[model samples]
Target chain A: MNPKDTSTGTLSYEQAGVNYDLIDPLKVAAQRAAAATGANLAAHGFTEVPASRGESAYVVDVGPFYLASIVECLGTKTLVADDMQKLTGKSYYDSIAQDTIAMAVNDLITVGATPLVVQAYWSAGGSDWFGDAQRSQALVAGWKRACDTCGVAWGGGETPALAGIVEAGRIDLAASCTGLVNPKERLSVGDKLAAGDAIVLLASSGIHANGLSLARKLVERLPQGYLTKLPDGTTYGEALLAPTVLYSPVTEALYKAGITPHYCANITGHGWRKLLRHPATLTYRIDKVPPVTPVLRFMQEHAKQDDREAYSTLNMGAGFALFVRAQDAQRTVEVAQAAGVAALVAGRVEAGPKQLLIEPLGIRFGDDDLQLR
Target chain B: MNPKDTSTGTLSYEQAGVNYDLIDPLKVAAQRAAAATGANLAAHGFTEVPASRGESAYVVDVGPFYLASIVECLGTKTLVADDMQKLTGKSYYDSIAQDTIAMAVNDLITVGATPLVVQAYWSAGGSDWFGDAQRSQALVAGWKRACDTCGVAWGGGETPALAGIVEAGRIDLAASCTGLVNPKERLSVGDKLAAGDAIVLLASSGIHANGLSLARKLVERLPQGYLTKLPDGTTYGEALLAPTVLYSPVTEALYKAGITPHYCANITGHGWRKLLRHPATLTYRIDKVPPVTPVLRFMQEHAKQDDREAYSTLNMGAGFALFVRAQDAQRTVEVAQAAGVAALVAGRVEAGPKQLLIEPLGIRFGDDDLQLR
Candidate 1:
């Protein structure tokens, strides 16, 4: 496998003056506050699947089926599209649509559910933002492609023309997805995750829809702006705009293959440190760190972010991770590879504290770094 | 019942710089382009329920069950929160949160699907905006109340600090909800909607969540800004921010009471004209239009809008409408009243060209006004 295809990822780096430390606590408080109302579901013949509340998506226990729903945003990634369209007269809306859907479906697959319907919420600062038919068509086309890749249907969505709330000329993109886990046996919420599980890493295409606020901030320091060239001669913006890898294929492949992973994690905002997302107290020891690609390397260099920050913030190649029994580890890798995603047995779950250790990089993230609970 | 609670309203009047003529075409193009992709739903063992698209929500046919999903936005409404915080020492985040969730869940109920999970997407132009703990807690509390009122779990959400993409110091709030329609019997898509069906109009509490852009534009003309008093002597912003009625309870009551409506509409954006949202060829006729109340009266009088514009642009008095068989008309009103929401049989359906006629007001909306299809 290509070393650049080996993957690890996180979302904590500060960029554009947005502080994760400040914003995260508000989310934590909101989650805790919402817990009281979770009981309201019981009145309507539904039950809360305990502990699924804080995960990337919330899982609901219906009588005959389990439903998983997630609401996610592409952040400021589409601002890159807005800028690039002005700079190159090229509409990247299609890929921007794909990026938004990828952000939703990718996180959903981690829970072992197959997405059934995907909805789009595209709010432009001005109504004229959609005046460009090329941009509109590209966006709709790209969104459809992403849904097709994920094997889900494009449900419906809202396109609000918010005049004063959004910034002029720029559009904010977000989406929500609903997936079903039938027979209840396919549900994986880390309860089955145990020490000694094999950790398989899946490769990211490149900075899949997180840390754009940081990346946008870093671009201002570049002499060429988005036109700066990387080692491969591709423009900085083009490289950054690479469509996010659809992790759904790998998850679907494994589910069909009957290889049950104890847990899965999408290495987005938190980078490689996300490998330790399991609730069980175990150490994620990484024996091999994926080689950093030029797009990520350029961003790290321009931003003066070190190995720890880059690997923990930019995917550094690893996009998603799966934890499975030792017996199923190789087959899981085979399934991902068969589905055209890079896969490797990068580490093992060890009986220890909840920490993520990158031995080759000589860096570690303590349990305190991940406080989603 | 109080005159203010006599019920039935719509938001159709034209408002500040937002032209549905220009915006609706883009939506039509996008929806048309997206229709090609909806066929992909069959890949996941699910099929798109025919003609469910272009309505308030999308309904998917899952063998033994039908799932309805909706993505709705609280357009520029949160800006009201941002302004109110500056005017008053108090934060209205709780009610803002309730309003956001109500927008999504209310639309879902129109299709007879009980909300199972609701996920929120809050995008701030900057991260520091959430630094206000009071604002965050208020938002969390209000969201919980809305969920509790509607009887659904606060599933999960994505809070993105999108610097430069949204207006600084403001947040763009939207949400998507997934609902379940089981036994396949409770579904109300207007298929059974016969001409002569009684039109039950449900009363809106106040401004609800629509037409804020126009209201905000009119507010600039006020010397007192948010503190400007209406005839009732309440501040303009406070009255406008009245909690939107959580319509889920009414839909749930009608479902449990064995009262099935042929169609339902959440009176927002397009106002009462949304009553014609059903694909069937039918006209909705209004005999007793609900009386306009204080908050709406204040805005219309101040904006110099006429009855046609007021009823069309804002909910005036009617908030939601239900199309039921003539025999079930009174029973539907009883069901809504029992659920704590004021409702009345305000009108009836007839065999004619698609249109909405308010005889008491001598105003009619032709089919050309609404172009969702």
Candidate 2:
């Protein structure tokens, strides 16, 4: 049960073959090249929000309003859903749809934008994949239902059978969301993130689509694979396939309450390290942390990762975080509850060297750990 | 050289393992589900343009302007680029970037929207695929160059390593474009499309990223594979990997010249059948057709497809089509030419049934040939 027990864990995201060292430079080079093209928006009467280049979503100034756009894939979570379907005889695509939608819409809301339209990208390896009417219909029903839940129009999408590129019998799911930042002043690109800001953490529903690659790697070692039961009496597959929390409603409720977060982090691929995602030289000090869910706990123990590696590489318990004025922390939590999402004041932002300190777990992430820009 | 010789080939797209019958229905089902979620847009002060549901791009009524968005993938074209790279000792990713960008941005402009920002999605089977710095940098340089050429900002993008979904050593390329359909009067979802409009056909640059699955299937039958040369002495892979034309500038130029097309069709996927894609019951009579490019001609000769199949499946020569009043035909051609795109008056829209007729080639496509909704 302790992360300090490293004897059993050898799992890290990099060891799962998704090394940031190889991937991050490409992103940094891309950001530099992307920065040069910002002026191109002027031709269409839209100007690029200079600081939005490396943010969760790309924001553009469209005269009276700022529009944000993001494209995100659900990663390998659907593979888990597929594997579970084989064991349980149930198509979990309804939740797969929610996870896919949340991955993109959640990132869009990080910049204080409310998503208006979402388009689906479903690329399958072969046409036979759709011949299974149950799975296909479940996907369709789920996509529409998720879009409705997020309050975004189910805009047109492309369904291509990419035979030779994508592996056979599998489908790759991704979504693109376009949102509006009305009133202009609501656009939060970390410009207002400063010292003494309160940090509100939102509870996640299991892994929530991140760290699935590492989680999938861990499954191979288990004697029973996805069918193995955790202490909670649920199969490992059921816990790992839990749907992601859609945070758009929480951001909407906060907006309605007239509380604009100085910055928000959609805790995704980079884990808690995302808390320092904004390019600000400040310390993120945490006094408390959420309890580890059963699935993540099972995965952490089986993978044999220490506290530092688990907290920085996986969401652990907090799926999302919002930085606000000190007095607004409790209000942010209440607003999330009104929208049916649980939240807590997990930490505070302080004027210090750039880093994150999870005091309860004794884990620290330095400024050099993340290099998005 | 005649397309009537179908005896030598059984290489239809369906036989190549990409069946439209199996794929299109899922799209239709998804579209129906998507339609139910259009009401969600109203919550963000945006209304869904009803007729836009089945169009190439999704349009939203944003008061002073209509916004259009589209997501499209290059579809195994990068596989061709990869094979060609292995043979030629050079990466054609610069052109690959253009093809990927064109797939989405061109579709966005079909609704008379000018692209404002384009985000890239480069997903590979593993991280090692990006280790080839030469190939990766070429892709980055090409993406930036294409965005600059289209007068759109290069908004942020996602590059994930999808281990088991995408095939190893291969990358899937796609883009999501958000564009502005300014003045509201410029938005064209075929409401104004009618008889007596001229059809201006714009020439294509080789295959332009479509029909590659069939094209790739043809490669296996060749003794030398990708290095095999055509009648023009260019290698089969070289011609197939040519960059797709960027038509955003043409749309922008037409708007500047005070000419609003009744409707426009980006000739992709369904080939000449796309001429009748507007859902209007009218006959598109093609008096003359652009000369088929060498690569497509080679593919037709090798694949032995009849004229009807060739015209109905591949772009053949025309890359884009614009439907405007007959009087504006010459001006449209001149405008496209001024923007450096070769275009000519190839046909006329006539009152009749829903179909497209290539008079010169004696090829015809019924309305049932394509069903996007």
Candidate 3:
């Protein structure tokens, strides 16, 4: 019934009000336009690392080392917490803080840069949004806990009370980070992505900070709102607001074990399709798809979304991906396990057109869908 | 005659809905909590610069070099642009972009760090907001122009369409930058702010990304809306939207001339009260207060504000303040002028309690007004 008319003839992300077709092109144009200003760095005695313009973070060559920085927002996930807070007397901002930091440090670590500092930007629609003492204390505790989890300092942040720019009762949360990729050789920008490379996927802690807008849209149709019980006996809102898995530990473990990833992708925004984010003429064929968590399945069934649409829009199971040499695949999974994260060799690269083929679902996404270039 | 009466019986910034009493303590508490997590950075071989926790930027001591990073928002200035767009068919996002970048890079340069790269976070309430191609193009062009003006690379940015969390049809613009302070001696954290240190005031174009909530409230009482002409013959909105002066050039000039400043303050949200943001117990005495710009005077007069509240809330005239030794004050102004920015010897630091004294206006702001610590 959706306008996109997928193979299932049911629903699509485009119909869910997220028109990636319009947004991706704008991002591409913005990147191209912004790249022209790279020459300005020369005046400050720093040069932008070549080909780092379109990555999750921008890396700049600062003489002896490279600094990677990124500014990311937590999206509408906090709205879910706010909704649940009204239904249940508990505050979920503690978990939301972890989700916020996870979104930033995950992208920061994807380039092998160890995050040094993380800054918070909490914009409340009204000053009264912080009147709840429990919520405020929980947010502070959780932000500090998340920073401790990732081995990054909790850098100071700006809390602006933006009365009219943001929604009256809700808060808009965002953060930016600076990480260091020293020795320069550790910088990963997908130059090593090639045929025969093995793709290893790290497990996600349920829906990790992506597709919340579409998920929130689906929540509106729920018969019981935030009180809806899921198959696992927990409330749906509680399950969806679970703290995200921090990936910097896995990355640090990999570095400790001397396993250098050729390419790394933070499984956010674009879902599992982020595995093929590298710019290379190779087919990424997934032989084994990870099991979907209960929260994801509940939202998928209720939203009337099929495998193709859901997998392409949310992190079905995979939270992060690493493409490394074929021999390093098993060891990479071992390092992830040592760091308390579950991971496995899920796919391989083949000499062919740029595509992502899912064997279990019989879904194939072409390069046209990934217009990051 | 009006609400929230002080002894002077005049309008106050607190009446305009921004209560620093609540917001300042929360910030102080958040900083205190975030500092406990700084020990996490030590594991990554990076240490937090002592006492840098509460500064404008969080500085990291990375062995041979020090890095300063900051995340600042453009405040409610964009709301003015949105309102102006409806009143007139023209978009003012271009100037808004400069204001956003100025908010970021200005903070970066305050620590004597040369801004190396700037990353933008432009989150719109809906995807359809970009349907207006002219407005989107203007924003991108303006962003790049501002980055160019600051002599920093326009590193990649995240343009997330955050529906429901942000106000519909509006965008929340903020940016983060990482700057390097090489030689380490270039770092300035008020340690060099002696009692006899002279203050060099840099002229502001108008209100630069602060006090827009009060300014907008004033606009409502206007007889002619955006077309309301001020004494300078320019409309109130037009003058307020003037591009912010990029202070990176001045900082760069100072760096080139080897005239390290004792302290620097970006006169933003807290206005001239920010001049005494340093922790030292010294009075910042302004014997030669700068002339009030036309746009600011209009906001004060029409809003029925006294000189004390006006100078304490808006920039009035001074955009930035640099405290240096009395001998280097003239050369600092000369260097600022060489960079094409207007500067003047506005004040001096005196041995007294922590306060800001506008002697010319017969007003004094105690340490209670500036409470980031």
Candidate 4:
């Protein structure tokens, strides 16, 4: 095992930047506010309201089918793209759009729904050079092209010209998508699972829009031009800018195959180990972990980042993880491969205390194992 | 006419302090990046995508109904809320949640769909004094309350603790809602709208979410303590923080009564006249426009705004407008009143060159007529 893969006992978001103290009070305030609204729901006319807080997405059973929608936006990624000077590249818009879709679709899929329509709201600083009619058209065109490919209808959106809040040359982009699911097939983390299931790994396309803030911090500390070069000759920016892998294909295949996995989690900004939010007496033995991609290696080498940190903070290589019956592993892999995705038997479920243990490496990674340092 | 409201000039985003030029380029870049991910939709095995851009929300057709979702966030609203030093107010979250719902549901209802579910996403700033645990809970509560009141379901959501992207105390809130629209009952803006239709008015809470950049600027320039008093003694901040009126009840009533309105428009941040976006000969005579709310009046007086400007920039007490057959005018008002809302027979729709002419006042207001001086 590489030493870099081990815990570094160093601080992260707390040290690099960001103030958790302030966040604590704000969170409390948010909860209070949300509670007040919840009390007012009946008067306001929202029926079938969820009972929990912080769950930003919801579904309503409308007769035989269900309606679901999700809202998300490209965070500081706008700033990163600006800093990297990649805003003009056609791929820039493409990546953000994908992120927007993934953010919404991933949530919808969690509840066993398929996306149908998507809407976006965009705000940008106003300048004659910035609001060029052609650029606006091109941006919208890219969104349409992406939505077209996703089998989702494109709903109308808002493009507000904000003058004060956003700095000049900066734009904020967010999207909302609606989907449909069978009420009987609604999937949630509460679904039952047993030991002895096989874990399947799906390859990821770089960072996929989640932990860019951390990545940017790490990159900023590196020596000049570190990201622009690599042993493979690909610019770090180019490598890191790889679009996120959309899991809809594999998910659909599984659905069609009549296989409902015990758990399916997308590896995003938080990584594979954090997928299970609850304690269960099951251990995961990951023996066939996919090899780390070049982007991960580059960040590790240049930023002196430890492997565990990298894996926890970014997708590394794998984009998604699915736990299913051991007997179904081969079929799952085959189905995924048939859909043009590389699926591997990365691990297995084992009987044990509710914990995530990485075999061979002798490491235990789970919610308990994660720390800012 | 108030001098402040009628002074027509170009209202560029820059004058409000947001730099749209810088933001536009960033928007272009983000869109380009998002496009790459779209191709994966096909690779992932989805079907029937649209070819229009700026559509961030999508819909899926189920046997008898269509499911649609929208994703959007309160752009710059977070900044404004933080600026007002009212981060903990229930009104803050309530208004934003209302706006999020309104943003998506308005569009859905415009096409004659019934909103069923609302999914929200909240990204808490790292330094927020309130931690996400409480904040997330509160947000869910708020969403649930909103959805329940509207007879919409509360779906789950995502609460991402974005360390680097969001500043502490500056939380971003967004929601996407899935709605059901009977195939046989679809509504479009191109429907048969003719002269002599009555334009019914539904009241608004306040400015709602749009034009914040400008409003903030004007407020910033006001003398200290300008918002300190009102005839009723409520603080200006409290008045501005009022939540938007939910139109679901009134809309649902109209739909149930089998009254196919010639046209329905949400009189949002853009005000009454911009509702005519189609290419038809139409004229609007707003003879009894609702009295401007105290909040709006105060803003106008403090900013030295003219009548036309105020009418164009703010909802000014009317949040929704409906163009109905002349015969249905009285029924529309009764329906609205039955729903516990105030309504007014504000205007009449007449045949003209796709223009909105405000008669009696002899002021014509339309998209082209809007100018920022």
Candidate 5:
């Protein structure tokens, strides 16, 4: 028996090598330390928006506007792309590049800031990685395409060849986005979040850059590895490599429709539990949920996880959540649809406790599940 | 007998695994692709500063002020810190943290922008690395201290535990800084670069986070590795771990003293070749150079590199350079001195073909050596 095996003998994120117990404290310490440096922004005629400290993105209050910034990385998904490329002599960097950009731009829009510029950080084990013209050019092309899709400049970036620290024949990818919230009114830090708000969840495409470490772990148990096909007839690697859905257009449409979400959460890392990411003492009640993508269903069944484990550890179906007044739910969905994205009015926010309740799956996660601050 | 060895049978940067010939074309391709996305910024009421495309930082015209941003990483330096920590049983993360911040913020200041917020990207191979409270806490303390030193907010960052791609028991460090250049006139993208400017050189503590891969390679040939004592009575590891000088103070002092440099170069990756960073057809003649630090001297002697190779591949001594009008050069030096940094009027710019001339060492580097765009 595996020493780290749980009582259920099933996979867990910690078993997959990501232990929140050891990682969250450092995050907390960083936030506490970061909190003390807010005063330093004053020298540049800007002030830290105190409410944005633990939010998805960092926001600063400039005189006529606000700027939100985030630095995010596509964790381990590139490894999957690399493995798949070896199986079928094709370059997957274009799709992975879109995934990396979506990972950052999606988080930036949570604070109602439209992304303005994105700087890339590509650390390769050696300079030889760029020798493949197809892969490298695809990455360049896909980066530009993603920036065009998000309407942000593909700003200059750093391409460092770190040999010893990064493993040979591998590349680590990340992006930093700086956004603009003009007129200052678009800044949303959850101060306006309240009860009786409708929760509209935007659909996710496949796994969508989160839970990849677990998914990649699950592949080892499969007979054919990444070639295993889901029930929908698509190979597992192809499904997981589907470029993430860009949500900027939907957020921009909601703004154009004069419907500002009281709070927005990019459902990443913590799966559906991210619905309660606003840090308010309110309960998120989900009555209806989107259909799980085939790739995610395959992961759920193969991992032998129950509803609680599946919903808490994977996106399940939703990739983003928007909390707005109950009356605007249908219009929010309409705007998302018009913007070429699928969204649904799935839940409501209620006063009482800080927890997430998925009624259809009979799953609930308490506040202790996430400790970003 | 080594097939890849140079004629002199001494180590070179390419032999150490960092090959610019293989890397520069990808950068050129990326710039070509990124240049296409510059128009995207116009939708958000901002425009890309066209001249800043290939500069140290990406600058955007935000109506009243300009925002310059850069994402830089401390390449392979952390591996040295990790190695030293094992030998000394002490945490060098505090110093490495400052080095990471300086790498990004120093690049930001090169555009005449005052850093307002810095966001970190810390990617560890596994979550267990954070279990070391001393090292992790030291990183937090040092990050906050660096922010305090630069007078910039330590904005929130992403701490992703990348298991498969990054090597186990190791971490990758990078930071992104967004700065503000107020009054528009302070924005320096080398538009005013002329033939009659004087070059001011600033002293570096040691190797300020550049050419670390080569330095780490040299340690492998040493009998005692990082524990080897230098002539200065300090271990090789200790000298390399010394915190890089935060140059924001010198830039701020220059701004206060009404000394707007025609161009500024943060001497990093290309070593002294970075002194000719600005894309101008002018010759930079250096009559005097800064005193080489002891650690650098040791690396030079052991690596068996001559003056030309050493200066081109390492900082040697000067970490930053300012090209100001001849009349303002002395005042700039005095301002830097008042800010507690040593500076010297080391060179002059002349109307000639693009190149760098080290008069004292009889070294000359033509324009073909550096190709950023």
Candidate 6:
């Protein structure tokens, strides 16, 4: 029996506070809208003009062995954070700055690159001219300070005073970052992956901004203290808002150490199953899933969510995962630990068609039929 | 006489069918919520990361003369496009793409860099198991085509299936770009502007996607053909959706011609008045504004807007303006013409506290109240 399936009530998109049904019509309309823009072409042809679609960032070769990537974040998180009143205690600017960094650097590392520069765009809600200025400066300064500490260059940004859409006190923050990747070190999903490789997990700080819809629903159902102060005295907000760990140092260390993992993936919104986009049948034998952090435990208990649902919806604890040679697993953990991350030899890979099986739990998830697929 | 100032009946954000006031409160709530996230940083030696209040994009240096800029368009346009049932026309995508390009390249050029690559993020309303594949492919292809035609590399992109906030038919498109600049050729507002530099104007295609809040209202009050179609028999959608003119060629021409303009500014959302960001008092004498394109004439007639309001909000005909030496005025126009852009001498510089004077009309606008400083 699934220990955590609490309520048998039907849970749908509307129940989760989102109307999923409207999406198809919206998409169809969007395609038609996109087609009408055929006349808007640039001189070099429309071939290289970045169409307004896809991932928040993309990579390009600027020179030999040097690549540039751009990354951005959706403003929806800002809306959620605002509704929760997370700014007064934590400095909303700081959370967004970290989010900006997380959004950018995560992608950089995913593509085997190191972040080098950061820029941000902040759209303030108010019409109080000076208030906007102060907030804009404060936000930029915080981002600059963070980037400076990370040894990344702080490129200038745009502060748009969008009075009509943004409210007096609200501000929407998005960031784009450029990073460099050595052409030879870039990794794609199709890169060869053989069975018997070890799968390593780097513990995550918690939610890290993706899957907020479900997380929000779970939080809404819980008693107040469940998110703010657990029985253990830890505030739920702090645990959930932990800035995504920057894996630059670790990835850079691995690169320098001449340890090239067969695959490295950021375990974000959709969790472990989404990472298996490669053409290999592999089963992961997990004798140890990281101990449930306090926040995760609270969410599971209060929301009555099943283990599979929790794992599928949240990062749980692992923010990044690595597929490496079984022989090199020990060294990989050592290297990651040296970089200050608590790395765990989470699982082992076995021969199979491209599949993800969680042992001990006996839960199997695959790319085919996945929620997002 | 302001013939286009048709009484749209005190139209406001809410009355325009968008609840800007309600959205404003939501914005404040969201900002406050985001602020609460900064207190969780325990290991990075940082207590709080400031909120990105107004900055929209961030740039970080990955290598010499190479920088990455990341940005996103708030889903405002997406919602509007979806409501209009013109999805495949891609007005939203194309507009956002142009705006993204404009925002990035304009900034890059401000710092004397050339944009070389662009990456985009597209979130379809949902994961249409079968339809998503084809739609995503087409979207990517369109984005790639745009980037390629602009002489920039179409790197990689992400198409996330976000089924919640975005309805089935609506998609949000955002992008980031990488640009290259010679350390020596960088330009800023402080670069130098004498009293005699002539201002050259390059034509704008249409509204080019900014100030839509007002434009849409005006369109609604007018007849069906008022905004999207003109007396010339061209569809207004096609005209309004005209792709932004890439200024790269013009910039390159000016550079190669050895005629460094006092300033080369893209006439976008804020128009002429916002261009006077420098400290010096400079007066602009406008003997000729580019011929009012059919779209502008239609907007003027239908909306019954004043010249100042129209010029300040829309690009009119000129998309880019250059402040060049009086002697090089003719050459600047010739070069722009050679690059397939119709350029003409629109105005000239004069001694005064840095001010933009639309002569003949005798209207002067400045950044006195708008300046962030």
> Candidate 1: where is the Cα deviation over 4 Å?
A1-12, B1-15
Q: Rank the candidates by DockQ, best first.
A: 5, 2, 3, 1, 4, 6
Please rank every candidate by TM-score, starting with the best: 5, 2, 3, 1, 4, 6
User: How displaced is residue B173 in candidate 1, in Å?
Assistant: 0.5
Could you estimate the TM-score for every candidate?
Answer: 0.94, 0.97, 0.96, 0.81, 0.97, 0.74
lDDT minimum window of 10 residues, candidate 4 chain A? A1-10
| Per-residue lDDT over A176-229 for candidate 4, one digit per residue giving the tens place of the 0 to 100 score | 766656544644333445678888888877767766655566665546542467
lDDT values of the candidates? Answer: 0.81, 0.88, 0.84, 0.60, 0.88, 0.56
Q: Which interface RMSD values do the candidates have, in the order shown?
A: 1.3, 0.9, 1.3, 6.3, 0.9, 9.5
Which residue pairs collide, candidate 3?
Answer: none
Candidate 5, position A315, lDDT: 89
Instruction: Place model 5 in a CAPRI quality band.
Output: high
- lDDT tens digits, residue span B231-333, model 4: 6676566676566677877888887777767667766545655556445657777888777778777776765657777676677788878778888998998
List model 3 lDDT by residue over B1-373, tens digit each. 1433432334567767786656766676688878888898778777888768667888899988898999988889988888888888899988998889999898888888888888888888888777778788888889888888788887887787777778888888899988888879999976777899999999999988888877777775777977899887998888879978899889888978979998899888778888978888998888897788899988888877888888878999999999998999999999999999889999899999998889888998998976657
How would you encode candidate 5's per-residue C-alpha lDDT over A1-373 as one tens digit per residue? 2544643468877777688888888988998999999998877767889988878899998787887888999888999999999998888999999999999999999988988999999998789888888999989989999999888998889888877767888899999999888767888889888999999999999899999978888887788999998888889999999989989988888998999888899988878878767777999899999999899999988888888998888888889999899999999999999988888999899988899999988888999987666
* Residues B1-373, model 6: lDDT tens digits: 1224335433332333333333343344334433333332222222321311222222223234434354545334434443343534433444445555554454445434456665555645445521534444444444545554455654544444544333455554556666654343444234566888888988876665555555556655655632355678876545555556667667767767887766666565555555564456667778887788786666655655577766766678877777888999999999988988899998888887666877766777875622422
TM-score of 6: 0.74
User: How many clashes in candidate 6?
Assistant: 111
Cα error, residue A263 of model 4, in Å, equals 3.0
The global Cα lDDT (0 to 1) of model 3 is 0.84
How far is A190's C-alpha from truth in model 5 (Å)? 0.5
Q: Write the per-residue lDDT of candidate 1 for residues B267-333, one digit (tens) a residue.
A: 9987766776777777888999777758888888777767877777788888888888899899988
Candidate achieving higher DockQ, 3 or 5: 5
Q: Output the TM-score of candidate 1.
A: 0.94
DockQ of each: 0.69, 0.82, 0.74, 0.29, 0.84, 0.16
